[model samples]
Target chain A: MNKEWPLWEVFIRSRQGLDHKHAGSLHAADAAMAIENARDVYTRRMEGVSIWVVESKHIHASNPDDAGALYDPANDKAYRHPTFYDLPDELKHM
Target chain B: MKNQSLIDYTLHLADNALIIGHRNSEWCGHGPILEQDIAISNIALDLIGQARNLYQYAAELKGDHATEDSLAYLRDGWDFKNLLITELPNGDWAQTILRQFFFSTYQYFLYQQLQHSKDERLAAIAAKALKEVTYHLRWSSEWVIRLGDGTDESKQRMEKAVEELYAFTGEMFLPTDYEKELATNGISVGPESLKEKWTDKVRSVFEEATLASPFKENNSAWMQSGGKEGKHTEHLGFVLAEMQFLQRAYPGAEW
Candidate 1:
């Protein structure tokens, strides 16, 4: 009934050799409880092989107001695309 | 009718799971928090799944168009052999968690032995269910410690829960006639053998939780029993009334 429990962000790795992706958030009294809560909430469907949890306060985010300055510069940089480089005929798999 | 004792044994196990699972399901949407709500419901689902497996085995033994649904929905209250502790009301969150911890601990050790049963199907079922029971034990144990060691009000409530539920713990270790017979044949474990290990685990957890062990105060205290023999608390009557209503009103009905 205590609504003041801190919020935590949950991340789950769906399988081996995969990176953890943001699943969602929940409130818990501590780290151990957060992990358990995340397990119940995010991995109930056999969705993950691993889980990671961090307090919401520990995660820093870039301000949405800076979206243009932070990401717009890369939008027109089509040269950064790997498709621009030609591959040798011998590199068939690439 | 070929192996009446075995069928009875299987139904006893199934009844325990189904009744407790039904009790836990009552908390589905009413949990104090959403995450915990899902957690208890998931545990309920696991128990019901175990019940289904057990009931299927029992039905096959009885062999006259018997099925798991019939076994679960058709039986009267007196026909059930679940432990009385499972049928008791979930008085509070603390009571429910404590009941789970005690029962899961008993099941944890019981299944460990059952995994080696002379019956192959029983052994296989025990092996699979052991994995789920392991998580239940851990989850319930952690909650017991948290609530027992938390603020004064929480600690007080945990103490009250222990007082309300501890006597029923004794019935878990008291084997019924069928259980005793099955134990002799190595088909199932005798509950008597599990008492020491269950007590040790509960005591250690209680120590860590800063709670006193009631068993230490009086090891020979009077305990409740008879559920395994089909006698149950009044609470089970209400539970069965609601659970069996649909099936009773409309026989052979299906979605």
Candidate 2:
């Protein structure tokens, strides 16, 4: 009947990934336990080479109410695409 | 420990993993937390995988149409050679953790020594299993310390777990005749000699956890035995009945 442990966000670097990706969340007593729990739950399929866990409280998220003000302007920026760049015929794979 | 003795020793190792792994699997979906439920299940799978490897090797050694499934599912409860400590019921979270601490600590040391076994298969299997057992040891040890130091109720539960499980531990060091032979032949390490190292490891962890050592000098005579000799508690019967039911009923059905 102990108080609920703190929530942690788990990130796993899959064997093919160069960076850890946010996988899921779990409750743990500490960082060490969080990492172990992450390994057991998220990497049971040989999915990851590394793991990182951060307290859920530590992550800041943008407010839903400000979503239009924060990101709507970027939606019309078609120049962000790299398709306009010219490339040699031999470089087509890129 | 050549031939039958070596086979017996291998079976002993297999049975330990199988029984304890079975016990841990009992925690599936029942853990206090969802993550730990998965955690214990993962450990259970590791142990059962180890058991499969050892049992498969044992089957090869037997070589008279013996198969891994047969060795695992066909054996009667009394035919199992796991330490009595492993067959005990999982009483509570504290008891489960403490039992795991005791067994995995011994396995950690045993596997480390076994990596150098004269038998190449045992050596290879031990080398592979040493990795998993190392994590098992760490996980269980951390929980033991956490629970022992956590709160009044937690500490009391851990203390009771230690007292209940400590007596069963002596049997791990009591070598059977075949084990003595294997130790002499360099096929396996002497279980009796591992006592001091096990004691040191257990004592250091206990000190950190602020728990008292439950060891008593004259406890061996009073400690339980006969599992290694094919005698077992009532618990093993129930465990086997459930574990072996599929094989028993299907009679060689394959998935």
Candidate 3:
């Protein structure tokens, strides 16, 4: 007789990072339960130092039909990638 | 004599872990949600891991080719010294969570004290097990709070769960002869001494959850015992029958 809870996208920060990467998704009754479920599901193996759970409904994704206009321009901007830079011989580790 | 008592005490701890770990595992693929399914299974694995360590140590004490598998898989109900609470059937989600909350709370305190035992290996095992039991306590207590306060149906179910399981809680503190000897040697915590703290912890959580304590009504509820002395309830027989099946059917089978 219980209704299905909301879907939450789980983001886990494995270490020091500016952003948490999407680990997976799960269903939880509320935001508090979402965080706890995210911890148990996505971070059981010392996988993350922090977790952020956002309801999937709250996320806005670009239409797949607009992918060409929204993303193709970035693909041609090869210089945006750090790999395009030539490191000095002394900075080999970089 | 000293070694025998140590082995007995060690098996007591191992049996509690093994039986409860097995009980928790019955929830696999049957949890209310997938995340909780994984969470409970992880807790089960932690308990079973603790049991493995204790069983290994016990095997070392008993030197006639006894192994962890033999101790865990070959033991009959009367040989298992797990407390009666651990062997009870996982009735419902409410019952499961409440049972876990009661036992894990006790284990958290017991392992905290055991971490300082004079026996070096037991202390080491307790130190490792304490970390896992801490999480188990938190997880189960949170569930207890949520269910007890969530909805009319949940509150009713949780109250029934608490009432049914509370009687078994007392047996966890009943001092066995081996435990008494170990207590004198600073190797085991005096079980009865822990009752006050256990009651306080349970009372505080129940209060927050808006559920009444069972202690208020039945201070003299008949308690089930004898598990520490290697006697157990009928439920344990079924648990062992299923758990010991593969090993019993195919002796010496291994991966």
Please report the candidate that would top DockQ against the real structure: 1
Model 2 lDDT per residue over A1-94, tens place: 6699999999999866488889999999999999988888898888899999999999999899999999999999989989798898888668
TM-score of chain B of 1: 0.98
Q: Which docking class does model 1 fall in?
A: high
State the displacement of the C-alpha of residue B170, model 3, in Å, after optimal TM-score superposition: 0.6
Return the TM-score for candidate 2, rounded to 2 decimals: 0.92
Candidate 1: where is the Cα deviation over 4 Å? A1-3, A82-85
Model 3 lDDT tens row, B157-201: 998998789888889889999999889999988899888889999
Q: What TM-score does model 3 achieve against the real structure?
A: 0.92
Candidate 2: segments with Cα more than 4 A from true spot: A15-17, A76-94, B217-221
Could you give the DockQ of candidate 1? 0.87
**What would the per-residue lDDT of candidate 1 be over residues A1-94, giving only the tens digit for each residue?**
7659999999999999999999999999999999999988898889999999999999999999999999999999998988978788888777
